[model samples]
Target: MRATEVAMALGEPDIHKRVEVVRTRLKRLIDKGWLAEHQRGQFSIVEGLNGAALNGAAADH
Candidate 1:
């Protein structure tokens, strides 16, 4: 999702924080080979695979 989309979903008021949060998380996932960035502002999981994006964070539960 775009940063704006993330921000809206998260109700994050700061645009810069929204971009930073999304970019940082996406970059980490890409680096781990869990996701592939298709374009400058787009990403998806590697093909032929399915998994949750939850780390050991709040979403893990």
Candidate 2:
């Protein structure tokens, strides 16, 4: 999801604050090699992180 989408998902009302939070999360994910930013404000999931366990748990929801 884009930053805006992520912000909305997190229930952020202010756009600027939303962007800030999304950017910070994205940067951290990138640093951990779990996510990559492709185009401007776009992101893609990268392999290597143990995200499967989280995904599996969420799948039951």
Candidate 3:
């Protein structure tokens, strides 16, 4: 999501600050190779991870 969208979703009144934080965190993740930046302001998960495994801890009893 875009920084604006992230700020809105977070209900942060200071959009600029929130956007900066989002950008910083995204950059860190990207640098660590945890997320792939699709473009200047877009990102996607890298391949090879199992979605079911990732969600397994939240499974309903």
TM-score top scorer: 2
Q: After superposition, how far is residue 24 of candidate 1 from its true place, in Å?
A: 0.7
C-alpha lDDT of all candidate models, in order: 0.66, 0.69, 0.63
**Highest-lDDT candidate:** 2
Model 3 is weakest, by summed lDDT over 10 consecutive residues, at 52-61
lDDT (Cα, tens digit) per residue for candidate 1, span 1-61: 6656655677777678666887787788677667677877777667754555556322222
- Candidate 1: C-alpha lDDT: 0.66
Q: Rank the candidates by lDDT, best first.
A: 2, 1, 3
**Tens digits of lDDT, candidate 2, 1-61:** 6877777777887578768888798878766567778888887777445455453332212
| Prediction 3 TM-score vs. true | 0.60
Q: In candidate 1, how many Å is residue 8 off?
A: 3.4
Candidate 1 — which pairs collide? none
Candidate 2: minimum summed lDDT over ten consecutive residues — where? 52-61
Worst 10 residues of 1 by lDDT: 52-61
Q: In angstroms, give how far residue 54 of model 1 lies from its true place.
A: 13
Which of candidates 2 and 3 reaches a greater TM-score? Answer: 2
TM-score of 2: 0.63
